[model samples]
Target: MDLSEIKGRIREKSNIVDVMAEYIRLQKVGKRYRAICPFHQDTKPSLYIDPEKEMFHCFGCGAGGDVFNFIMLIERLDFMGAMKLLAERAGITIGDIEHKKGD
Candidate 1:
């Protein structure tokens, strides 16, 4: 397993709504979920989640991305750190991936 493989597993195993629910309260709206944007001071539900696309977008503050990006921003972690965190959440081991020459 490499970075791409890890990402794929994370996407496959993690649901956007489920992950977002851990950070904020979500209300189902039509086919998506709505929540107050975590990136800014939001009074109304401005963050929308599209589970089919596995993506989220904030209309009020313009914060948006996939689950990994959300985790990175919300957790204040870099790419690899977010990957490791999400891997653990998805029950995938980072040790399964072969380390690069210098890493």
Candidate 2:
């Protein structure tokens, strides 16, 4: 599949809380999950994860995004690499997509 298709699959299969919990400990807070920001030296919980939105944001470091973006930042991966990683984690296979000359 193409990048957009892969991204959609990743988002549908990967839960924000589940993926984030794999990297850090998370505590339920109201309608979201809270944890210390891994992108910075956070002494207090500054990362908030919204499962409903499938997104995360750090109040301390200003880092935020969906599951793919989170993985890209945390794992230091490019877009394709992040997609492959999350696809593997979600047991979703991404078939090779032929890119156009300009793409």
User: Which candidate leads in TM-score?
Assistant: 2
Over 4 Å off, model 2: 98-103
Which residue runs does candidate 1 get wrong by more than 4 Å?
A: 96-103
Clashing residue pairs in candidate 1 are none
Q: How do the predictions measure up, each by TM-score?
A: 0.90, 0.91
Tens digit per residue, CA lDDT, model 2, 1-103: 5666667778899998999899999999899999989999999999999999988999998999998889999999998899889889889888886554544
> What is each predicted model's overall lDDT from 0 to 1?
0.88, 0.88
Tell me the tens digit of each residue's lDDT in model 1 across 1-103.
6667677888888888898899999999899899988899999999999999999999998899999899999999997888888889889887766666644
Worst 10 residues of 2 by lDDT: 94-103
TM-score of 2: 0.91
